[model samples]
Target: MSFTDFFAIDWSGQAVERPKGLAVAHARAGTEAPEIVDRAWSRQDVLEWLEQLARDGTRALIGLDLSPAFPFHDEGTYFPGWEASPVDGPALWQLVDELSADDPHLSATSFINHPHARRHFRQRGDCGDLFPPGRGRFRVCEHGQEAMRLSPYSCFNLVGASQVGKSSLTGMRVLHRLRSKLGLWPFDPMPETGPVLVEIYTALPARLAGMRKGISKIRDRETLDTLLAAFGSAPHRPLPRYDDHATDAMLSAAWLRVAAAQSELWSPTLLTPELACTEGWTFGVP
Candidate 1:
């Protein structure tokens, strides 16, 4: 199964009227550049957009910059000590979907504010105890990323700039809504055809482009162009204002174009059925 196009989304978990951080970009099979699909998008808009692509029979590999699952193994379960803890990734997503069914725009406030479940996440005023400082607050896959020197934060820590907890939780709502329309890598068997979604970390591709630490945001046109060049993509002229989000989305799409061609990325040597079904692995993480 080969992909004819690639997409990458830099998702935002904010519950604002409009999220400026959310960006989408795509690269066609033979295209020399990955173009931004939209300058701004709400979570619902993204969901509908992907569904339309699926309806159109577009066979693309989609990468989302968010953790698809939590640190289940390290904590024994997402909601430890709960009587009805989810058994796997699907169940976990379903629970979030059910909890946030009334949330507008696929926002995950309910799950984030749940009385019991809220204890696992770090909110504005209160920092969750599930992940303490100076100690590891990561999933098994995150540990693997750490081994490679990539600082992948835990999905439960939602306080800092690098934290992905909020975005990932909100992403669950979108994933649950599109589960039937798109195949989720590792969680669902790779379909012989049609669109498929995979969890992506933008840092992986940025690192591949020689991006170094201390430089979290890529704002320079020359630097962005240099990164895109690694994937054979044309340089960006008059680069967009939201360079961080745009570049992240663009570079991620470019990375997917090359990474998807490698059979090993789809088949990690250490991936087990349990890991795939529970703590999802980040695509491109060996």
Candidate 2:
């Protein structure tokens, strides 16, 4: 008998072919050589591959750049909010409280209650339908849908002292690791903590302008800054103004319309962004 395996990792914002993909071939016994490489991918690219790759009794080793042990800062510690925990901590509970205060959606209680809250957590929740009665998948419900949808958002306010490098370093390190996993460059493991000095490169104004066409409205500084940075440069500007009610209404309406339409029948966003925000379900995964 011979065996084969597949390995893949997400690079940048999408998945790229990994060198390990070509490594496995039908073999009786012998260590297969590892192949590593990095390639860019769009959302559609990955979806097509997944559709083709899903098959009976086949498994692919997959990796993502996102933190795996998020919300698990210390084995004995706990946080009430924020899925992404600091590599180090000022006690997990206190950290979570701070995150909860900043971002109301993040909560330790939610992590415990939600099914897909852990990044690396794995289990076969629907395996009962995949067996022959009690032995193999001979009689199973075909209409039973597996896997539940999840919220794709989390936000926080920058507090008294700016932890400017904190987010930047963490995000960049994840990006770099993705690149490395795809064999795009030499592997660089970021020290779990420290002042990792780095720079971010992106067209701010252009990016914000693009989001505006799809956005219904803005709530916090982060979303506003992201939009303003992309819309136009306010030179020597400390922060963007967001108190104009008329502008909010316009943006809110535009954002809600698109988000609702995109959700189709799976999930529905109300007709206005303001209503959507107040409802705490601004977007839906259909």
Best by TM-score: 1
RMSD (Cα, Å) for all candidates, in order, is 1.6, 23.2
Candidate 1 lDDT over 1-286, as tens digits, reads: 5889999999998877468899998888864688888646888889889999899888999999998888878677877867777999888889998998888777888888877777777766886665456533677888888887788776777777877888898898888888878889899987877898999999989987888875777887788888888877777655547479998998899889988888888888778888899988899998
| True lDDT of residue 105, candidate 2 | 18
Q: For model 2, how does the per-residue alpha-carbon lDDT over 74-158 read when each residue is reduced to its tens digit?
A: 2321222434543332222233343334332121333222332232222134322211222111000000111122112111111
List the candidate 2 regions with Cα displacement exceeding 4 Å. Answer: 1-3, 13-32, 36-39, 73-286
lDDT of each: 0.83, 0.25
Local error of candidate 2 at residue 208 (angstroms): 43
lDDT of 2: 0.25
TM-scores for candidates 1 onward, in order = 0.94, 0.21
What CA RMSD would candidate 1 show? 1.6
Question: Cα deviation in Å at residue 131, candidate 2?
Answer: 46
Q: Note the clash tally of each candidate.
A: 0, 18
Error of 1 at 184 (Å): 0.6
